[model samples]
Target chain A: MRIEIPGEEYMVSGHLACPGCGAALSMRFALKALGGKIIVVLPACCWSIIAGPFPYSSLKVPIVHVAFETGGATGAGVKAALEMQGDTETTVVVWAGDGGTFDIGLQSLSGAAERNDDFIYVCYDNEAYMNTGMQRSSATPYLSWTTTTPANQPKENPKKDIMEIMAAHRIPYAATATIAYPEDFIRKLQQANSTRGFKFIHVLSPCPPGWRIDPELSIKISRLAVQSKIFPLYEVEGGEKYTMNFEPKGILVDEYIRLQGRFSHLSEGEIELIQENVDKEWNRLRKKAGG
Target chain B: MKKVLTGNQAVAHGVLLSRAEVISAYPITPQTTIVENLAELCADGILEAKFLRVESEHSALASIIGASMVGARTFTATSSQGLALMHEMLHWAAGSRLPIVMANVNRALGAPWNIWNDQTDSLSQRDTGWIQLYCENNQEVLDTVIQAYMIAEEVYIPVMVVLDAFFLSHTSEPVEIPEGGEVDKFLPKYHARYKCDVNDPHSFNLMVSPEYYQEFRYKIQYAMEEAKKVAKRVDDLFAKSFGRGYGPIEGHLCDDAEVILVTTGTVTSTSRGTIARMRERGVKVGLLKIKMFRPFPREEVKEALRGAQKVAVIDRNISFGCGGIFGHEIKATLCDEEKRPQVFDFVTGLGGRDVTPSLITEIIEYTCQNERPEGEIIWAGMRG
Candidate 1:
């Protein structure tokens, strides 16, 4: 399989990202796909630090680190300004974490999507608020143990289906990708860049410390998440057409969860419940994709 | 061309003449017509700008912050609760040094949800480092909105052009709409010193450690001080292009007055009428209208009030535990003066109640009869 990734390096080596950070890899692939003629609007997220501090930056492209909930609005603004300045070629992309995307930033994101504003919104989902420490966000999966949701009182609710939310807006493009699948991630970003209106790409990034996983296992865990059907890799066009990007390996949910310490306290019954939930969701997604 | 325009319509024309590249806003009372007019202007192909109709006030300000960073002349307007909602982004806009101009029509903050005129909304944003300009009429509203872009762009600070909700925003007056060519000559297209450029890629509003954060803040304050001079320069240049000028503070017969009345927004207009009537009756009263609030016009305020035996501050807004908002600022301004007037803080006409000429007469009479101010807040026209 000749999975060709761009050789051009837009991201530098001296970023402040943790070892094997999935978000860092996702940004690298995104920047590579989108190239240099782009400005990234970052809301409060792990990427805020990962993008490096003032007087220093990791990416070659310009970045504007805005307020937490302003990802969507800020992206739209950047696009509007670019259009006003007669520089419509420059793509405006918003890179945010799960907390900014699914929780705090959802309103702005929904707004931009509704307007079909010209920008690409990328949600680097590490599940919880990884920057402030492992706290539960709406994107946190069922029974996941965050710092707020301790082992005894784990997350009870299922993760919010953000893809559905994005699809509901009937935006021009919406997709799910992960760092493990570099080709798919880059392809979706390039496609999003080519399309005119508001585009959303949800990347299932893995947090090493927050997810209680070894630094080296981030990619492995991300791949397992796709194969185990816990996080499906797919795309939606104009909120209706759904396309499954990858064929899941049909790995068991326990195999995916066992490696992470966040799920260490889960009983067999809880694991079964999670498997059942994942199966149901996978079936629903397959149906949407017309099997 | 002399045309009768509401304060909101004046704002739309000012923005149009200034050639603002981007306008973003959320609908709130008294401020809605400003954006509605702009929307019509944009849709009719009269104004070459992007009108981003955002979902909330937070997004309205946030979008402009982004637009300003991208080197576009941006504007937004909101009132009361909307301004409160945009508090966080207001700091962001100023800290980033994006010269985004905003019109805040002063409406009362509410738990009972009353939407009428007051100074509390923009006053609450006083600490946010935005250069605030209060307008007394529709002409000043138009003029200030045009000058704000020049002042803000020059100092690299955001400016809030404030006006009374019903008094100025809704009230129509014959405003001299400056020719677009004249405005273009006064204020040129915004040339940002620093902006988001992919070719010369850099990061903005990034995480600054304690080592450099204070210096960044110092720069903002330093620019604020510079804004005072820039504001004056812009006003002079504006007067050159168009035949009108409004400095940070406008004094009416204050030099020889025994008692002075300090006011802001439309209250200044009402006070002007009151001053003329009192002067006719041989009562030595003056009017000092404070146009610029954020940079406070401290020195100008002190200089104007220095000769008066007593200065009565009629405030339409209170600061919760602290007396009147402007009253506290005036006292603080005069605190270090070697010889200052007996400053009386009078709170009146809160939540859209009229500040009539009779009310002004009672305030002045009370101040003249008393030797000293009894308390922090003397509620004027309180039904005992």
Candidate 2:
């Protein structure tokens, strides 16, 4: 079987994204699948800087950089205005970071989801607040070393299950994709594009400097996250029917943890604990998928 | 057609007539009826607009900002706490230079948690780059909302049409609701000069270095200066269509008066009656109702109070530590004037305390009896 990716590129170069920035790559793929008929509602994220400064934009699409916690509401508004204009062809996509989706912007996002407002919300999860110099966010994994959560006292809480929260809203579409799988990423984005109301796509975006990984190893680490079953490639339809898009090799969590300095302080025992947690989550997801 | 409408319902009718393309709002007391009326209008097909019942006031304004960015005429309404919650978005809306109009029903902020009328809610937002026009009655509330869209769209600055809670928001008054065709002729459909478009794509509100950041703010200030003229011109145009006009400030019997009471919102109505009775009783008292507070009709204020020896600024809202918010602005406006009147700040009717005719008379008497203001703020009708 053959998989196809669109040749047309909506994102342009000269953006200020760091080397191997997964979030930036995610946007490139997103715009590729979404085509030119979209307006991006960007909140306070790394993309805010990566989209280039004033008088210079890195995308061929129009961008409305809104307040930090207003990603969902702003997108809803754009879609509403477009609906009023009788232009239903344009898709209003909210390109937000994990901090916006999981933390400060949660209420607005939830509000939009609850109302089943017609828009696509994409959260590029880099695990931490990478734009703000690698602070600990609710999306930051347990035992990860961030600027706020130092090595001695790493992040005590586990990464929030954002998918479950979004699924509870019973939105039309919700999916998880990573940059390592461009075909899957593009396919999911296209699927979200076609869906009518309140679609959410979660991309496990990697950060090089913030994740304490070699810039070149960003995509490799993203692949390992999926292979280890730590970050599953999946989709939820109407908050129920779950389909695992990519069946992982189900490797141990050590390979995913060892590539980055964020988890360097973790002992063998802690790695085992993380493995147990990942396995538990994988099992729960498998049961939901009726595997 | 003349209809007896509350200030809130008048706002809905104004928005309906103005042909606002999108309406996004969250319900808050005193402001709820405005949105409720709008919802019904949209449902009944009387207003062909999309009404977004957002979760919070922050989203309420944020959504409208997005709508306005995409070249849609948008509006929202909220009271004190809801307005306070929307403080961040208020700055965002103005900074983005989206000409969105919002009706703010004046309600007191909480600590002890009061939900009644006061000016502090909108007054505190003076520097948010929004043109604030306070209304003295329901008629002005409806008129100002329509004029706000014209003025804001002209200058590309957000405008806040503010009215007192309960007094104007709930009280019914006969308002001349203009026909849709006449309003359409007066305030035409909003066509954004710059907007988010697919054909001509651009990023807005991006990170700007110091080299160009100051210029953006300079333009906003420059636009504010332009808004003062636009506001007056829009009012003139509105009167040409609707047969009634409200200037930035209105002065009654100020030419030969010894004492002038400066007021805003519904209190101005009471002050008007008090000034007439005082004039009949052989006391030289005048009434100056400030309709626009933001691009604060400074020249009009100075001209009206030039002959008056004593000016009492009646504030239904306190600025805390400073004096009345309007009182401070009035004092600053007259600071450079050669024959400026002695401005006395009298704070009363806070937290919805009644600003009765007797209260107005007492405020005037206090201004007359005193040689100068004994203090920065004289607490009127306050228990010892």
Candidate 3:
């Protein structure tokens, strides 16, 4: 397969992101797809640090760093203001962490989406709060070992069904993408950019330090997540119409889990429990997709 | 032609005349009527602007921020918890310097969830870098909204035009709704010097390290200081054309009074009424209305209070653990003065509790009779 690199590079090379950071790659691919006519609204997260310091920005596009819990609202505001100026050609994309999107920013995000605010909201899921040091977030998977949730007591809550919550808004577009699928990810971005009203793209980005995974295996782990049916790639149009983009091989969830240290402490029973949950979720998604 | 209009309707008319391209808002009590009127205007084609029906107050502010960054003259109105929800983006709007104007109908914050008049909501955001302008009446509310955009765009700072909750927001008074052309002459199109331009790309509100963070903050402070002059110029230009004027601080009988009451927003009107009644009875009292709260008008405040024997600050908002919101600011401004007036702090009218002219009279009479307490905040109207 011929892999085509993006012709335009909106993201600069000297970003302060960690080596092989999946969230950084997600940003690169997103900016590449959206092009220079983009305004990135970022909330407090790893990306906040990754964007580099002021007067020394890493992206060629304009970035508006908002508060941790205001990504959706800020993006909506930016988009509204832009349209007011008769500049509807530019795309407003909100890039937020799982903590920002799923937890603190959920109310605002839900509000914007429900209003069908003309903008793109991308929740880069790193699972935990990597910016303020890895604390447990709502997006943190059950049985995950975040600093706040030690092995003795892993995350008590299951990973929030963010895509479902977004879908509930009956938004024009909502999709799941991953760093390992650049083509698919870019395609979704282009689709979202063209669509009117609220469009959401949930990117399952891997965090090397927070996830306690080998930096080199970031992409590999992300791929395994889909292959294992742990994080399926799918899209919903107008919220109700669901379309699964990729079919997982239904590999053992342990294969995806073994790559990360955070899940290493899990016992066989716990791993099996997670596998059951993944399978159950995939089945439900398949049913929704009319497969 | 002067017409009696509610403060909310006056603000709506100001936004309409200012030619705001977008108005996004959620319905919060005391502030709901402003956005509701705006929505009606859009529906009636009285204003050619997008009236976004945002689901929450957070989204309302956010939508305006987005609109303003792309070079739109954007506006929104909210109060209380709504303002708190937009607390995070308040920094974003100012840091991005979008010059988005907001009308914050001041209300009490929640735990008990009471929705009434108080300065706590807006005053709590004093550090968010927004240029705050408090209005004393419907006329000021109407005029200040027009001037806020001018001052905000000039200094590249987001401006918050605050009105007393039920006092100004709901109360009806005669306000001159400036003509569109007149407003156009006074307020220029919002042409942002630095904005999110795609063709000529540049990063905005980017992360800053210690080396550049201080400079960024310093520049914001410099812009705020510059806003003081811009505010004065805008007010002057406004008066020249409309034949009325206001300042960062409005002095009422302060020229030769022995005691001056320092207040803000609609309370200033009641204070003036109280001062007038007192003067008839041979009490030498005056009023100092603080219109601008962010740049604080520290030098102007000190100069205004310099002649008074005692200055009693009446605050409607509490800092909780600290005393009154305005009292602290007043003391901070007078801290370095060698011969300062005896500063008496009085906290009253929180959560939209009424502060009639008689209340002001009592506070002043008490201050004159007793030794002015230093560093102590006296609750004037709280009943057990």
DockQ score of each predicted structure, in the order shown = 0.89, 0.89, 0.64
**TM-score of each predicted structure versus truth:** 0.99, 0.99, 0.94
* lDDT (tens digit, per residue) of candidate 2 on A88-144: 899999999999999999999999999999999999999999998999999999899
Task: Score residue B304 of candidate 2 by CA lDDT.
Answer: 90
Question: lDDT winner among the candidates?
Answer: 1
Please tell me which predicted candidate would have the highest DockQ against the true structure.
1
Give the count of colliding residue pairs in each prediction.
0, 0, 10
Model 3 lDDT tens row, B1-384:
789999999999889888899888989898989988999999998898877787787777777776776678889999989999888778878887778899999999888988889899999999999999999999999998989888888899999999988888888998877778888888877787877677876666666667778888899999999999999999999999898899999888998999999999888888877898899999989889999999889989999998888999999999989999898998899989998888899999988899988888889998898776745888888787
Q: Worst 10-residue stretch by lDDT in candidate 2 chain A?
A: A1-10
Compute the DockQ of candidate 1.
0.89
Clash pairs for candidate 2: none
Point out the higher-scoring one by lDDT: 1 or 3. Answer: 1
Model 2 lDDT per residue over B353-379, tens place: 898999888889988998998899999
For candidate 3, list the clashing residue pairs, or say none: A54-B207, A77-B62, A77-B63, A77-B66, A77-B67, A78-B66, A80-B67, A81-B66, A81-B67, A81-B68
Off by over 4 Å in 2: none
How far off is each candidate at the interface, as Cα RMSD in Å? 0.7, 0.6, 1.8
Q: How far is B145's C-alpha from truth in model 2 (Å)?
A: 1.2
